[model samples]
Target chain A: MIRTAISAMLLASAAPALAEIHSVAPGEGAQERLQEALILAEPGDEIVLAAGRYELTDGLSLDVDGVTVRGAGMDGTVLDFTTQAGAGEGLLVTSDNVTLRDFAMENPKGDGIKSKGADNIVYYRIRVTWTRGPHPENGAYAIYPVESTGVLVDGVKVTGASDAGIYVGQSDRITVRNSIAEANVAGIEIENSRNALVEHNIATRNTGGILVFDLPDLPVMGGGNVIVANNLVVANDTANFAPPGNIVAGVRRGTGIMVMANEDVLIENNILSGNPTAPVMVIAYVQPYDDERYNPLPRGVVVGQNTFDGGGYDPQLEGGEMLKAAFGGELPPVMWDGLGSLYVTGDAPGWSLNLTEQGKGLGAAQPAPLAAPAPEAEFDRTGIGAPAELEARLSR
Target chain B: MKFGTASLLAASLLLAGTVIARATPPPEQYVNDAAIMDGGLPRLLSDYGFFADAPAQEPVPEVHPYRLNTPLYSDGADKFRFIYRPAGAQISASGEGLLDIPVGSALIKTFAFGEGKDRRLIETRVLLHRADGWLALPYLWNEEQTDARLAVAGARIDLTTPRGEAISYRVPNKNQCKECHGLDREVVPIGPKARNLSGDWLEQMVAAGHIDRMPQGADRLPLWEHRGKSSVEDAARAYLDVNCAHCHRPGATASNSGLDLRWEQDDARALGIMKRPTAAGRGAGNLLFDVVPGDPDASILLHRMIVNEPGVAMPELGKATVDEEGVEAVRKWIAGMEPR
Candidate 1:
């Protein structure tokens, strides 16, 4: 401890302007002490939390820009909010250029580690869990970053969220990679966002895995330019436990790599296994919206090469038994609602509902074998991830 | 930078004139300008000297009391509001927007329960306008009601609210204060918008020379006490503007929800009329739209307001119990709407 403090002092003196470390430990008054450090921290300061369980009551927040809040490790330093009394989230970050890593929050009454309107934020090596596993009353989102530019969520694990785990909404230049989203309603959902790169994430045991969507009547609209690649999407057949009135409550249980109401989306290089429903589902927004600015179609979506194994064995469609029997005891891998511009490459067997327009129910479907054309050109790969400068903060 | 320097020089010149005109030594009622301008956090509420008698909730000389047309409900706790401007500084107005108080000003609000001899101060929330921006802090009152101390992470008091419900009243933490006061990534004052301030109070400030003139949109919101004399829509909109607009407007905390309830917003969709929920997870309560015309029970906007749970509640902070009166006003307005 003495050596660490001495080195921190040396670093502070060397910089003379930035790099001040405020170290806090868990004990009585841990809530006040840690929250005070977060509130009073200056720009470029680091608030280091020692390894222990912080039994906090209310929510904590950090609004100082360019600050770093680090803990010993995800398991070593746990922020236990089992008795959280008030506030919307366990930890709220409303400032820019903030880095939070190596910590865990358990059983918050609301969300866990929400960063709203906080730009260039990096959340690394963090873990958020309900501890009681899947339940309807769990917080909405874990590791949520919304309405921000340049968001990077790397090496995080989220479980038992009633809504999406690692949910990024209405943001641009985002990357969510090297994460584990398990037992949540929707694992790793990118909604109402643009220029996102979701790669190399392990998404399993959730209701749906890796959803790229665009909903209407949001401040930031027209979500597109997404790349969902190189991930493990398997066994996402968990029953949807989302609360009533949530949009995620409508998600099918065994969906994998679904895209809705978006354009220029590329889904490729994923390992899909053990998913009972369709391995890849592409469709449009089903709800009728009054916003004129909204186009409820998935245009220019490309489904590339992926390894599908043992999926669609027990389908969750409207007529599962008849459809599966007609398809030789197991349904095809890809399922489309037949309302969008979908292109598939490399000859993946699939089927389509052949819906005529948006907001049509299953009664309007004419189910048939899917036939889609190859893409005219390669998918655009420009500016499709978090800014490269965000990775530098993780190294520190 | 140049404007700041010039303003400082002008303020100092005005201060010199006041010093020369004074007959006796300035009383101890003077506000501590250093405390407001200091970068360090004041440990105790008394350190800022905002109140002459901290227990009695009495303000110092430059601290002036003001009342809004319709006030926000905080578990029915009676609020004492005050605005403190430096002796030489001046406040300017801009239509119905926020009054541009000088950088050294502060807004102080104290929450108390009970009346007369039974009154007990619960907490005090202060907004200090430093050079950088507004800084909000919460202070928890002691059991003796002598002075409140800074509760940086906030505290919960197991006390009975005005409605006789035994509840844990929450004192919002420093960052939670920013949740309601934040605008466009900056902490700002939310209550002193010109439309919400009473017209008589504006004219009084103008007569006192603290303000240049009465703002254009002064006294537009329906008065809370006289809501029966006004339209139900005006009363409900005033209640929502006072309570929800701080976070629901554009560039605020709930701005991503696409519901802007500010008084000046005339568009029906922008006001959450038949607008679908965006990020209102379980708060939507199985309702389809935010405001369902002619169906108060089906409106998600009213549904969130009446609930007191953490994740499901609107305003998300500073409220524990249902504001039944506020709910009734909104219910009447929604019920009166013409259904499409």
Candidate 2:
């Protein structure tokens, strides 16, 4: 008995210390208390918010690494910024290994949740929404992670952003899955990023479903190796409400997926339907640009096995002018801008369109005429195999 | 009697030497104290005494006191009085052409409204130079207006402007202040550039021993009222430089857009002339380019400037109302542009 007691005591002593949990309740100065908790938290500390509405003026920022901020539930705990007077983001994380979960941010003056130059950030079960619906005055982004690495956003629902609902820019090794994006300009945008995996997300009633784009003159470039698969992208016929001069403004109303100026992107196994414009579009980054460092061609794209239902009727005449001219009013399920360099020495082309097991209606438009000619034989199924293999090769 | 006079003279000289030595001590090491009082306030401000007298008087000349070339336009609600206080003898200019203020310096900007008997002080934002980085501290004035208290989380004050406009002035938190003030992901001063300070202020700073020498060929940024006085291009560029360049400059927060509006930037694309918007959503206002050469109405820059919407507005923060005069100036400049 004595030996057993000693062993139990030793084991108890050997275990790590219990992490500190700071709880905040709604009160006159609840925001202040929460802010104090964030500032006072150490590594491995958890700051929990009770189930109530907390009205905040200034946004909250966490710079303590290895801290966890949790709420009672996404629908129970609410952080409302309706009367926000500051310009800072709702929840700005500038620390590594920070996990934010089970919270909802409402009506921020700026971005909802933003992480800058941080790494190993995980956001789970978070909802960011504008209460007044979509307008030009809405915040720019719902969940914006910029210049970060190893970011994982899962089970988040975002809506009513003037810009992209879930935007990952200038980041690397990002995974956004099991999210719902609705009523935003671009539903889920992976811009100027590398090695992103977007899968199993439900994108509906947005301007465009998913976008993989590389903008010029950013700190990071050469965005590639993006896999967008097994998602339900449907009825994204929302009129592009994005303000002018943004790259998303060029997106057609009903585009399911768009790949612009990116390389080695694999699109597979998604259910795309009810999009009036082309379901999938591959185009060059031919906007009037001055940065010479950016590559403007989409190369090595493999599209396969996506179930398409009811699309390409009543296309956006103005937004999809090129596509409309090429394939008439009834657009195709997949479209490509056939403008890129040719392979000089090798038997293969610089950019190859590998389409297999896709449900019909695919077309390509030449760069010069901007009109529909006969389908080019070179772009017609260059014998690329399964999308999984292509994805594996590209990722490597 | 002669011996007594000699001893008295020696004592006076000793006292003078003590005073001089105390005035010119090395910069104090920084400590990250959450409570601003822990750093020993009232004493820190009084000992350093960047101002010549208490309760807002003249500035101490030896502190290398200076002012901005053009002030950033806050909401029409409050007016600001800005002063720069370098820690040591002089400010060393960095190779990147920005003022490398030594640690322990401070940028003090006092926000107030009205003048004379109706004047009411709002708050003072102090950008303290620390070893790790610049720390922003906001001190809210008491009702009596005799003193201020350090408010870290920030405060909101409702007041009427001199123009009879009722406004709610939001004192930004420390992170909010760093939002635009951060450069290359590091907290730095927004103003005090060679191009912005190329006017008489540079000469005055040089004369007061604030800087060793003035940078050659530095372009001067004119005040906003100089719209009608100077060339339209100069006035427009100055307005953008003061209001937008802090975030729009290269390596700054808005550099992701590929637009650099620093006064020294000569590239047409960097200046956003005929440049397409990168990530602008509805901020583009259906315009084709940021600037459409000869068409101001068609320029997204002007559209963002004129709008008060959250996503479409330019400068994004610090202003609740539009600066009609600034918008008109830029409009005239763009209207007068020759199409490329």
Instruction: Judging by DockQ against the true structure, name the best candidate.
Output: 1
Candidate 2 docking classification: acceptable
Per-residue lDDT of candidate 1, residues A143-248 (tens digit): 8899999999999999999888889999999999999999999999999999999999999999999899999888899999999999999999999888767788
True contacts kept of 1: 0.57
| lDDT by residue for model 2 (B251-318), tens | 66676677888777898987888777766655676687888889999998899889875545677666
Screening candidate 2 with a backbone cut-off below 3 angstroms (N, C-alpha, C), the clashing residue pairs are A242-B281, A242-B282, A243-B281, A243-B282, A243-B283, A243-B284, A244-B284, A244-B285, A245-B277, A246-B280
* lDDT score for candidate 2 against the true structure: 0.70
Report the error of model 1 at residue A392, Å: 2.6
Residue B8 lDDT (model 2): 32
Best model number under TM-score:
1
Candidate 2 lDDT for residue A164: 95
The CA lDDT at A125 in model 2 is: 88
| Clash count (model 2, backbone only) | 10
Per-model lDDT = 0.87, 0.70
Regions more than 4 Å wrong, model 1: A1-18, B1-29
